[model samples]
Target: MFGTDTDARNAQQPDKPIICEVIDPTGTPLNVRATPNGEEIVTTLSNGRQVIPYKVSYDEKNRHWILIGDSLHSWGWVYGSYVSCLSA
Candidate 1:
């Protein structure tokens, strides 16, 4: 209702570096995975913690995955469902 189809898709893709906060519905630390799936968890992030994503990725079913950190840095993948974009 707000943006066009392309705009909506583009909004999901971060153009500038920004931070999103962790928001686990389970009231605990959220799992940061090596990939989008639940199989390989690389780290755990507490609620309200901020993460900087290099870009957004999608799973086979089109679920959003945030590429936390960078490929050459301390990076991991986290499902976008557990994160809330604060700005940008």
Candidate 2:
């Protein structure tokens, strides 16, 4: 599982629902991985798709990754750089 300090910080915060939109500049569907920066793609999200961020982790290169889904189901992880989140 994710064990980054950023992930720890997010775990300490209250479970506030934050909505984020996929904004892949290439206009192609964004790959949702099973782990941060992982090659295993669990799914794909198109631009404008709204998702709820459940957790966050940063990779060694400092790329941000978010765990996204609804309240009951977790879709997977996506590169945070391609997502635009609004304040909750």
Candidate 3:
């Protein structure tokens, strides 16, 4: 439904839809954790943590994933409404 017949007729590129670019709130840092429950925090997302955030791997039953500065990582499931795209 996101595309037209031209999309369905051609070889589908599923990778595009699975990726989401995120911009954290300015002046506020975010936490990258080993688990979604906020334990085992891996890294501290500094102010202006501009990067693509991955949560639960786009409905992945196994786990989640996030891309930090070209590094592919994983995360927990986050609802769409809970995330906001900040303006640069």
Using lDDT as the measure, which candidate wins?
A: 2
On a 0 to 100 scale, what is the lDDT of residue 62 in model 1?
Answer: 70
What is the lDDT ranking, best to worst?
Answer: 2, 1, 3
lDDT of 1 by residue, 23-71 (tens): 8889878888887765888889898887766656678887777766633
Which regions in candidate 1 have their CA more than 4 angstroms from the true location? 1-15, 70-74
How many angstroms is residue 32 displaced in model 3 relative to the true structure, after the best TM-score fit?
Answer: 0.6
> lDDT tens string, model 3, 15-83?
543323443444455565555533566666554334544323322343233323334644432322223
C-alpha lDDT of candidate 1 relative to the true structure: 0.67
**lDDT of the structure predicted as candidate 3:** 0.37
Highest TM-score against the true fold, candidate: 2
Q: Which ten residues in a row have the lowest lDDT in candidate 2?
A: 1-10
TM-score of every candidate relative to the true structure: 0.73, 0.80, 0.38
As a TM-score, model 3 comes out at 0.38
Give lDDT: candidate 2, residue 65: 85
Off by over 4 Å in 3: 1-14, 17-27, 53-88
Q: Quick one: ranking by TM-score, best first?
A: 2, 1, 3
